[model samples]
Target: MDCLNCFEITARLHMYIDRELNSEEIAIVQEHLEDCPSCECRFHFDMRIKRLVHERCTIQHAPQHLREAVMRLAHAPAGTYAELDPELVKEIKADLKGGG
Candidate 1:
């Protein structure tokens, strides 16, 4: 197997850690990390950071008011939102058109 370059491997490292890559891609990245000291160090560093963040972070549910506001905004008619925030309504319309 041809080892990928650090840039290519690192670009996909997040996907690898997330288990989002296929088996072949994972194997290629693993092989590259085994042969490349610098990339290996970087990979380990990123992994450690992610682990720390995961350990330290706590999921917080949105406050009821915020959730209600979002629900209202999401369900509001275009003209209704225009009266509240014309610019935001325009952006929302654009985003809807762009399939966001």
Candidate 2:
């Protein structure tokens, strides 16, 4: 089946190939692909790229110390969001009070 629009379909071809779209959206994509040859080519190309990435990429394990550091950071104080500045906190409080 010929693709309906080779150009416009390239824009969202990846998302469609990934099956990320809902059922209604899938129907639209299928209809378009069925009518357009260029779009089918683009979809095939995108699938090739995804397959290559899956074949070549490898996942890595986090270091032991990294896990421990995360545990400590997660247990830190409620107000301490991260890299907190004592001087900035004082400035914010002063601003809230309408004082320097």
Candidate 3:
């Protein structure tokens, strides 16, 4: 395979990370990474991000109280206001603001 430029390698990086590329394409990317330090660093960074997202997105059971609150909201009649824990509200607001 011809030598891949940084742009080409980076563009196909997600596919490489996901193992979606064919053997030839994967070989090309590996060859490029072996020769290019910058792309290797980027590959490591991107892999870390991928791992972080996967870990965070994995399904886990919600807290019992939170589950109960959601059930209450689900069962509430229209126009009824369900009271939320003040700390939970603040935490939710912080998360929305990217501070959580």
What is the C-alpha lDDT profile of model 1 across 1-100, one tens digit per residue? 4667788888988998889999999999988888999988988998999999998896766545545557887888876742345655566567557764
> By summed lDDT, which 10 consecutive residues of candidate 1 come out lowest?
81-90
Error of 2 at 41 (Å): 0.6
**Top-down TM-score ranking:** 3, 1, 2
| Model 2 ranges off by over 4 Å | 1-5, 60-100
What is the number of residue pairs that collide in model 3? Answer: 0
lDDT of 2 at 35: 80
Q: Which residue pairs collide, candidate 3?
A: none
How many clashes does each candidate structure show, in the order listed?
0, 7, 0
Q: Ten residues in a row with the worst lDDT in model 3?
A: 91-100
Error of 2 at 79 (Å): 21
The candidate 2 region of ten consecutive residues with least summed lDDT is 1-10
Give residue 76's error in model 3 in angstroms: 28
RMSD of each: 10.3, 12.3, 6.9
Across 1-100, the per-residue lDDT of candidate 2 in tens digits comes to 2333556567767878888877776777888888877777778888998999988896655445445556767999988866535665565566557732
